[model samples]
Target: MKKKLGLTSKIFIGILLGAILGLILKGMPDSTFKNTILLNGILKVMGSGFITAIKMLVVPLVFVSLVCGSSSMGDVKKLGRIGIKTLCFYLITTAVAITLALGIGKLINPGIGLDMSSLITQKPTIGESKSLVDIVLGMIPANPIQSLASGEMLQIIVFSLLLGIAISMVGKKAEPIKNLFESANEICMKMVSIIMLLAPYGVFALITNTFATTGFDAIFSLLKYMFAVSLTLVLQAFVVYASMVKLSTGLKLKPFFKKFASVAAVTFSTASSNAALPLTIESMEEIGVDNSVASFTLPLGATINMDGTAIMQGVACIFISQLYGIDLGINALLTIILTATLASVGTAGVPGVGMITLSMVLTSVGLPLEGIGLIMGVDRLLDMARTTVNVMGDCACTLVVSNSEGEFNKDMYYGKDCNNLNKLSESELNKDMHQDEDCNNLNELVD
Candidate 1:
């Protein structure tokens, strides 16, 4: 019998095979194979189904996990501190990512020779942007049910935070509710595992369709733009994130990378941070991050922290500017950074979100929104790469927060049995019950 391969191995194989199949279809002269069969048939159905399945879980998972995280904190003050730190860290990293991308784009000049003016452009309909005050006020959902229905992640986060704090303040009276979320969280995580079983096949269809539709000529024509964006993503993920993790937690890079490679692959394949949260949280637990920290930070990170997207905006802005023969002054670069940073939050969790924010960034600096369509050919591929970096940013923030709180598990993170690590066991829960009265008698109930 053939030995069973791990999920990661299977996913990698799916991606490989999908790429080969896509290339074969791309090379074919007749449009019959790609247009009639691959693009519109098997690949379309499976890919759409997979993305839908993942999205279905996002709201519930985030809601339950975040409530569990908030209630577990036991102290409202600490929760506040965690919130502040997480926000600051996310924003800081985003600024850094964008800054780096701008610097690199300038050096590489990815758009110098690309003349796209003759291409007709359709004006994208953009709603009036919210002011800073409006944005802050909007965080408190007028109707949380509406927020949930619409999948408004920022509103969900705010409402969940308030709910969790209220539960914590209620003390033993809220134990039943808290326990319910814990159970719900566990069930949801199991659902994630079940869904992930389809990842290999789903990823195959997604990749195959992407490559088959996006011709090699378009990809190669803008190879330099692709190279710059890809290079910046790689640098942000490895050099910048690795450095932050090392400096913050004193954790070894080898084990972190070993564990994170799997998460990165999922992020790349799915291109949705919310979709990858279940696995990311699971990986964090296996690496020994405290449940409270991992649950809170990762969900919040997914919703608000978008360093990878920031990098893309920064690079794309410069590339577009160069293509138009527009010279960017220091003030224009600053505007791009500020606009991109704020836009990342304003546009959180929308489908095809990057291009929307890219348009906003372009408008901020007097660059034409039409320039966005010029890069659409390679955007799908770059979206995959940047999404990987985005999730990596979330994981890095989780570790940093975990370390600062002294909740990080250096031993589990470095241990050889990391893959086999399970959730908190019965005996452990019992011991915790004996130690803390406010644990809501979870041991008794769960046992």
Candidate 2:
């Protein structure tokens, strides 16, 4: 018998192949085939279509899962504890991420003698940013249906939390709606599995389009800024997250990352945390996070947690300050830290969100708004890396909170159980899972 390749391996292979194809495409002359047929035609359609598929389920999944998870908790007070703990972990990590970003940005000084000609932005428009009070008020949806239609994640989360708590209070009288949501959750989970079957293909197309259009040209022009952001991301993901998980839960490093690699690949390709939310939750559950905890924490974390975004804003603030010859002293740095940390809670999880928030950070200390226009070229490249870190932050927070609440499965996380999906990296894990009558429909649904 031969071993079958896992999703993680397949995704990596797609990335490598995509990079090769992209580089080849980049070297070719501009033509109708390259622009219209190849890059814009096949690659764009496949990549965008796949992302759309993933996003198709995010709203319903978050809503139903949170409701089901919150209602399962008989004691409503525990909800307050988990919510507060989750926010604290997210904000603290965001603060720490920005602080590290500042340290590295100053050390590298990416803006010294930076190329002014490389900036692609034609205008100095700074996007409108809501005040802190406005952001807090906005979280409580004016109309939840409108919020859901608009995909306002914070608003949806608030409504779902209140509705779930109401159901939990009503006890047996809420059984019908509770059962309805639980069933809907199962369907949403099924949709995630079906969509993931196409991941390698989608990831390949997305990476292929990005590298083909970008090539190596963008990096050299802004190499220092790119390097600073990349280094900070690596540190946050590997060092910050690894140490936090180890100290908090005593979990081993290798298996944890191995399980998370599949999720990382998708997030890196899409560059949108919301697009990756479904897989993020599924991965946490497989890693032995309790269903209730995974359901609640992962969604909330995705919406409120912006550690990776904070890292970029911190670096960008210093980068812009140095580029334009402005001095951001200690008071300004402290202000940046506080503003970025709180802004993390206010912002939604989506692509280009960091850029919007970057404007706010730069404005806070009187740095030039035109500076936002400076890094637009390479931000897309850096964005992929940051999104990977953002999602890792979410999962790490979920694991730690789960442990604190005594909901983490020690045996499963350690891979000692026969049915442990976390331990089973091969195809047999899927086979084993399908043996259960509850999941018997999974295969048929996909078929």
Best by lDDT: 2
TM-score of 1: 0.58
| Candidate 2 wrongly placed segments (more than 4 Å) | 1-78, 115-221, 420-447
In Å, residue 385's CA in model 1 sits off its true spot by 0.9
Write one digit per residue (lDDT tens) for candidate 2, span 280-351. 888888878898988888777776678889999999988877766666767677767866775665354544
The C-alpha stretches of model 1 lying farther than 4 A from their native spots are 1-78, 117-221, 416-447
Across residues 150-262, which tens digit of lDDT does each residue of candidate 1 receive?
76555676787678768988889999999998899778777777876776777777667545645343345368888888899999988999999888877788877788888
lDDT of 1: 0.73
lDDT of 2: 0.74
Cα RMSD for candidates in order: 12.2, 14.2
Among residues 3 or more apart in sequence or in different chains, the pairs in candidate 2 whose N, CA or C atoms overlap within 3 Å are none
Our tally of clashes for model 1 stands at: 0
- Candidate No. with top TM-score: 1
Cα deviation of 137 in candidate 2 (Å)? 20
lDDT of 2 at 197: 64
